[model samples]
Target: MDIRQRLATNLRRLRLEKGWSQEEFADQAGIHRTYVSDIERGARNPTITVVERLARPLGMSPSELLA
Candidate 1:
């Protein structure tokens, strides 16, 4: 899969592993819930800053998120 697909898969897997609902994850990530949905769906081309926001709550680096 491509980076977007990889991110979508990893993000969903990580979020589920954390037992966090999308809304809850979004809150913890300091991002919008809908945006998180879009990201999980591989529909959003998140910038580095937004990737950082997501990575922080997941206890990983942005590169990890992409990986």
Candidate 2:
């Protein structure tokens, strides 16, 4: 899969593994729920800053998620 797809898949997996709903994940990441949904659906190309914000709460690094 492409990077966007991979990112979405990984994000969903991590969130589910932590028993978090989209809203919960979004809150923890300090982002809007709609934006989180867009990311999870692979409909948005997040900037580096956004990626870092997401990765921090997911207990991962931006590079790790990108990889």
Candidate 3:
């Protein structure tokens, strides 16, 4: 898959593993719930910094999220 798709898949998988809904995951990631939904849907092209923020709560690195 493409990087966006990879990120979306990984993000969703990790979030599910943590038992957090999209809203809960967004709260933990310090981003908007809609943004999280967008990312999970591969509908947003977030910056590297935002990727880092998303990864932080899941104990991952941005690269992991994009992998």
Candidate 4:
């Protein structure tokens, strides 16, 4: 898969693993739920900064999210 797809897949998996909804994940990540949805759908190409923001709540690094 491409990076966007990889990111989306990993994000979804991590969120599910943590038993969090998009809103919950977004709240913890300090981002908008809509943005989280966009990322999960692979419709948003997040910057490294955004990745960092999201990764923090997931207990992972941006590179791990990319993986």
How do all models score by TM-score?
Answer: 0.96, 0.95, 0.96, 0.97
Q: Which stretches of candidate 3 lie over 4 Å from their true place?
A: none
**Model 1 TM-score relative to the real fold:** 0.96
Alpha-carbon runs more than 4 Å astray in model 2: none
Question: How should the candidates be ordered by TM-score, best one leading?
Answer: 4, 1, 3, 2
Q: Write the per-residue lDDT of candidate 2 for residues 8-46, one digit (tens) a residue.
A: 999999999999999999999999999999999999999
The whole-model C-alpha lDDT of candidate 2 against the native structure comes to 0.93
Stronger candidate by TM-score (2 vs 4): 4
Which lDDT tens digits does candidate 4 get at residues 1-67? 9999999999999999999999999999999999999999999999999999989998889999898
Candidate 1, residue 13: the lDDT equals: 99
Name model 1 segments beyond 4 Å from true: none
Clashes (backbone N, CA, C under 3 Å), per candidate, total 0, 0, 0, 0
Per-residue alpha-carbon lDDT of candidate 3 for residues 1-67, written as tens digits (9 for 90 to 100): 9899899999999899989999999999899999999999999999999999999999978887787
Compared with the true structure, all predictions reach lDDT values of: 0.95, 0.93, 0.93, 0.95
Q: Cα lDDT of model 4 overall?
A: 0.95
For candidate 2, the per-residue lDDT at 56 reads 95
Regions of model 4 farther than 4 Å from truth: none
